[model samples]
Target: MKVVETIKAVRNEVIAAKQTGFSIGFVPTMGYLHEGHVSLIEAARKDHDFVVLSIFVNPLQFGPNEDLDRYPRDFQRDEKIAQKAGVDVIFYPSVHEMYPTNMPMSIHVTSGVDVLCGSSRPGHFDGVATVVMKLLQIVQPNEAYFGQKDAQQLAIIMNMVEAFNVPVNIHGCPTVREEDGLAKSSRNVYLTNEDRAEAPFLYEALKEGANLILSGETRRSVILAELENRLGTGSGRIDYVDVLRYPSLEQSEQLSGKVILAVAYFYKNARLIDNYIVDIQEGEK
Candidate 1:
């Protein structure tokens, strides 16, 4: 339950914990802690001896016109939540601590950046990958936890860690949802009551799409069309509905291997994303 604000401070704590033979678990988040975040921290607590939670809202992750300033901030509130969730050290750093200067190089995956949330947000996943890379390096945990709700993000980090051969294990924990099946998110607070009612349909459509593929209806167009239509029933504008090879995030006419059914919907105050990943064997179910 220690909150330290510099990279050195976190490293000192992490090194001390490791010297005591405690395995570290890391959860990197932009503030506004929620049920989704708690799920990841709980997963880490279940497996690791020590947990480090970093709460810097990365400026690089926000787009130029994307309301970076107005995103949200309440360290006092988040600190209470993190301690309750069993975090051992909270790495709360400033933008300067993370960036220091314009980054000399950025981690960008060529394949996954062209679709889903990455397509609209441009350099968003690059920012995500970069920041996660920084945190993973800074914290140097035995395992790091991420929610599967950001399936594309999970995939990106998974790919990056593999390519770069980062030592930590990346765990894509299951997406936690509401009683009515909506994927829990920090952005859920912004949804108008009308948008909230319709938001659960995103998860429903994902479930339905997975069912369709499993039932021998494997055409990509049909699946995407069904999801777009289902969620776009005049509720919010449909950003994209995609079925892609998972982890790689590449598209193909015929689905195989790990596949993810993903969507992003634009409500009045929030743009929400959700997905369902299944290991698809086209003929054998």
Candidate 2:
């Protein structure tokens, strides 16, 4: 795979590909390649004529005291992984190359910006939307792939694209998990052995929430209480446990339509998040 660090270099190649009538598929990521990331690249490879994967640990998306500096980086390893995953080009740009000046304008959505991770980490989604907007503009891909693991972030980006009328199509892929049911994350490496053992409960709790919803329990508060009971095993301090309407991130009484059961917890100095999305049956009212 061709790896270029400059935006101009990447843009020239993308323009060339477009001129040749090739549809571009883009997967934007913060480097620390895992099987979850590879899964997205594989999906893009299957669908698009040309696939571009970007590895930029966007500083704008990180909070002031967050793990921006200590967040992992291994470009050599990531390069090998991307090439093996069939990426046609890797946009490995430095932070300065991508952000030459201070971010004058930021992207924010009023509705979904105050819950889940947004509650704790304020301005997180704003950074996410801004960088994603910049990347979409730079890559100019026909389709972009994002994992559903960050269900809220995915929803916010979808809303941003729709609100701004960006031309690129966004595809949300399924969450990839480990054999033990822990949703795969680059931050999983920070887990201690004990913390790792207790981590799968996040997924388990989400599954239990789904089961409760399926078994005719329609009240969101009831399911949320049960979810908190399951996650409050003292394994890690609970950050938030929410069941919001999917994509919109709004609260609802009836459980019909797309709904997401989500949890975020702090375990062993690493913050972990997991969620399960369920499409509730319509005639349950």
Candidate 3:
């Protein structure tokens, strides 16, 4: 696999690939590669003629008090994983290379930015949208792959693409989880042994909430309360547990259409999030 650190070089390569009629698939990540990230790359490899994986820890997407400085990263390890997953190019740009001097303006998907992780983190999704927009513009891939693990992020990116008329297909892959049921995340490395043991409860709680809704419960309050109660036993603090309409991500009061059951919490010093979607059955009023 070829690794290019400069935007000019990467863009030139992409341009050349496009001239050859290669459909590029892009996967933007912050390094610290794991099965979750690999899953995204693998999916992109299968669908596109050329795959580009970016490994820049976007400072804009991280809050001031967040784990930006300590966020896990190992480029050598990540490159190997990407190559094994059939990645054609790895864009390992530095912060300076991305931002440069006098980098003005940012992109924000206003609607979905005020809820869930967006509301909690403050400017998190704006950073996300901005960086993603930049990447989309720079890479100019035919399609981009994102994991459903960041359900809100996925929603916000799709919203930005639609609202801004960016011409790239956004594909959301299934959430990859650990053997113990904890959704895989780069932040999972921050968890203490005890915290790791308790982390799986987040998914368990989300599953229980979906089960409650599927078993004929329509009261949003009751479903959320039950999920909170279940997650309370974990060592971390529960940030939020919400059920919302699938792609739009508006809060849902009933299990109709594509509904998502999502949760976020803190384990040790790391913040984690997970979600699942359930299609309401027909004639289930």
Clashes of each: 0, 0, 0
Candidate 2 Cα lDDT to native: 0.90
Off by over 4 Å in 2: 282-285
Considering lDDT, where higher is better, how would the candidates rank from best to worst?
A: 2, 1, 3
Q: lDDT (CA) for every model shown?
A: 0.88, 0.90, 0.87
Candidate 2 least-lDDT 10 residues: 276-285
Pairs in clash, predicted candidate 3:
none
lDDT for each residue of candidate 2 in 13-108, tens digit (9 for 90 to 100): 899999999999999999899998999999999989999999999887788999999999999999999999999999999888988899778886
The parts of candidate 1 lying over 4 Å away from their true place are 282-285
- Best model number under TM-score: 2
lDDT of 2 at 32: 95
Model 3 weakest 10-residue run by lDDT: 276-285
Q: Give candidate 3 regions above 4 Å deviation.
A: 282-285
Ranked by TM-score from best down, the candidates are 2, 1, 3
Backbone clashes in model 2, listed as residue pairs: none
Per-candidate TM-scores read 0.96, 0.97, 0.95
